[model samples]
Target: MMDVLIETRGLTRNYGEICALKPLDLRVNNGEWLSIMGHSGSGKSTLLNLLGGLDRPSDGFIRVGGEDLRVLSEDGMARYRREFVGIIFQQHHLIPYLTAVENIMMAQYFHSVPDEAEARTALERVGLGHRLKNRPGELSGGEQQRVCIARAIINSPRLLLGDEPTGNLDHGSTRVVMELLSELRAEEQFTIIMVTHNHEVAAWGDRTIYLDDGVMVREELKGD
Candidate 1:
């Protein structure tokens, strides 16, 4: 039997009077790679935030791994983000002064305790073993993103969320990042929900859903 890791019903989100996401339902199976694609102002990031528990829905239900997100308190949501979700954004968001390994260790510091050994392992897993001591300013865009990936997986989260993770990368860099993510997902068995405007990036996932004006207009199976 297939395991359902995330489910939403009539999910909606609004900012002031603007509806960012309309009433919709979504289901994501365990370990599935689901991509969300849309043009600007199409609610792609809003949906990703809601799923990551970084933002709450204005109405309806959202459940991940059997936990209903709507009912979580602020602290509860923080805990959920720390323990269950790992996120990567278009911006590296690294401390300019911190070394690659330190940046990853910082993520660990928030989750529980910072462990240098584990942080090093995470960086190594992302193929950054040789660049551990380099600060964000010293690394290339792709290398900086690799550090972010290491930091994201350092917590061993059950779900990974990416908001235009490869948006700033060149074609070669994007390929490297996506390939690394695929390998990491296979080893960790985590579900991935990524938002991207690029069709090539969306095609990396098993399925892609397209949103328009806050509504899901259509979806396509990867190989169909």
Candidate 2:
């Protein structure tokens, strides 16, 4: 059996009278790839935010690596995110002034001492060896996103979370990014959970869970 890496029970998030997440229950095992799908207001992002400790749940439990997120303080959550969770968004969010190499190194610097050599290796792994010195403004959208991926994994996170990673890219770039994500996940063996609206894109995941109005509606497993 696969080892469970993420677990949630009755997880919920609320904003005033609006309930963004309604007691969601989910489990993702280590090295597994999961996609989340839902309508615009389906609370998919909210779910991702809660799992990533970007937001707190109003009720229920969230356990990753045997640590309950609810019990963590602000600093604790920041430490958790730095050490255990890697996050990506449709926006590359790269520093405009920094080169790809520098962007990757920034992560290392914040968490601890920076390793320039390791940062370069990470960019090379993402097939950006030739663009290591290129700043975000100089690189194409796809290249910038690759740099983001390299930065995300530089710390060797145990879980990778993405929100609309390909939402703004063209079809070709979407495929390119997805392929890179798959390759890296396999090489690193981190659990991945992506939130996307495109069914075709969601199909790339090993399993997919559908959401509606903050509730888990269904799940589909495509593993053979």
Candidate 3:
């Protein structure tokens, strides 16, 4: 049986009077690729932020890889984010002044020690070895995203969270990025939770769940 890697019980978040996410109970099995689909304001990003330890829930609990986020201190949560979770945003989030390899090394720096060789290897893994010295502006959109992927995985995080990771790419680039993610997942066995509005992108996962108005309204396993 697949072990539960992430679980949330009555997980909720509020922005003053606005409830961004309703009380939610969810579980994600280890090594599973789970896709989240929702319209704007459906709380997908909110949930991702909560799971990644970037934001705290106003109520309830989140447990991932044996750590209870509710019980963790601010520093503890930061450690969890650095050591356990990798996040990719629609924007590549690379520093404009940094080269591709340097951008990846930055993530390593935050995690612990930065090793240029390790950073170069990560860039190579993402097919950016030749562009190591290129800044984000000097690379194509697809290449920039590849650099982001390398940076995200440099720490070998157990959980990878993607928020519309391909939203900024064209169809071909989208396919390339998704395929690369699949390849990485196959080799690394890291659990992936991706949020996207695109059905085709959601199809890349093992299962897909749809959120509507902050509620999980539908869920489908692959081949169902």
Model 3 whole-model lDDT (C-alpha atoms): 0.94
lDDT of 1 by residue, 1-224 (tens): 88999999999999999999999899999999999999999999999999999999999999999999999999999999999999998998999989999999899999999999999999999999999999999999999999999999999999999999999999999999999999999999999999998899999999999999999999999898
What is the lDDT of every predicted structure here? 0.95, 0.91, 0.94
Winner on TM-score between 2 and 3 is 3
Candidate 2, pairs of clashing residues: none
Global CA lDDT of candidate 1, please?
0.95
Model 3: C-alpha RMSD to truth?
0.7
Candidate topping lDDT: 1
Tell me the TM-score of each prediction against the true structure: 0.98, 0.97, 0.98
Ranking by lDDT: 1, 3, 2
TM-score of 1: 0.98
lDDT of 3 at 109: 93
Measured over all alpha carbons after superposition, the RMSD of each candidate to the real structure, in angstroms, is 0.8, 1.2, 0.7
Error of 3 at 73 (Å): 1.3
Cα error of candidate 2 at position 189, Å: 0.6
